[model samples]
Target: MEGKPEDDGGDLTRRGFLGGTGAALVVAGVPTLGGVGVEEEGVSTQLLEAVPQTAIRVTVNGTEHRVEVEDRWTLNEFLRDHIGLTGSKIGCNRGECGACTVLLDGEPVYSCSTLAVWADGREIVTVEGLERGGDVSPLQQAFMDHNAAQCGFCTPGQLMTATALLDRIPQPTTGEVREAMVGNLCRCSNYNAIVEAVLAAAATSGSGGAQ
Candidate 1:
């Protein structure tokens, strides 16, 4: 009696029907594209959710600028785009050309490579900030007088770097000036004029003669 079969075909049919219904329900719950289950939606949403907006306040040339930027926005973009200070050229954009150089707390720094958020609460000085009472700085005047600028694309960065150097050294020798200006490059190959301008500025400042 214990081993005898019940011969319940109805029971077997019910079990198979239940199993098929469960499988259909599972298929219905899953997302499908062209009759195939796809997992792209969740991934895209996750990626979008991961991005964050950043806010920072930067003081440039004695002016405070408040901007909302993404985490990846660079200081160069903030200066050129938001603040409308485009003197810092976007050459190379990887900190190689030194064309995007600016002063941060009186120290020369590459704007292209520096993050905007990193400059929060810090003082930034650009080439546009070098003018005094509608007149250019002494270094800028010397550059013009000596004809140190050709093409003039890299002049702003050069001026900033030179300004920082002179601020520190006051009187820099030709060799020292050359060493200090190593970061800036001129496509016109106007190194002689550039050096002359720096020397002239030193003389005007009464910082002694070039060594």
Candidate 2:
């Protein structure tokens, strides 16, 4: 037999090196965005499209919104970015910090860890929602009165958690207040003031209702 060409020993051309001749990537439930598609050599590729979207109806601060959100987005991102409610800060970007806490159906939850899709048909309350008739809620006023917010970064989360406690107990003891707010970490270490504010609000008006 004739000697084979040296090039026949798998000369690694870019095209030949590829494992597959035609490549396609398809993800279920993902929608294509506005972009152009190009085809070459019987292979088709699309521009980067958005991730999977979920249309949800959520009531925030007594206002209902029907919006489309990417499935991977967190609740904090949805509120601050999409809904224009930036009170919930993204501190630590994890559940531990509690800076992104918000009330979901009258319960405090870490928005940073929760998915926006989980809020479908549910009520959400942020620090912005604590106002009634152009006036801050009793709990908020108490916080200011007691100077509970030193840095104010964690105030929103603290206030949200306190609001839930007062709503349930309506007059939680100092120990109860401390226990309930344990999840919220205050960098300023103003625990006493925060507890005082919550107690004061409860004594005056336990209307920490999620409005």
lDDT of 1 by residue, 59-150 (tens): 88878878776577789988876566878998889988788999998889999998888888888999989887787888888999999999
Kindly give the number of clashing pairs for every candidate.
0, 0
Most accurate candidate by TM-score: 2
Candidate lDDT scores, in order, read 0.79, 0.84
* Runs off by more than 4 Å, candidate 1: 1-51, 206-211
lDDT of 1 at 145: 95
Model 1, C-alpha of 177: deviation from truth (Å): 0.3
Per-candidate RMSD, Å:
24.0, 16.6
TM-score of 2: 0.78
lDDT of predicted model 1: 0.79
lDDT of 2: 0.84
TM-score of each: 0.74, 0.78
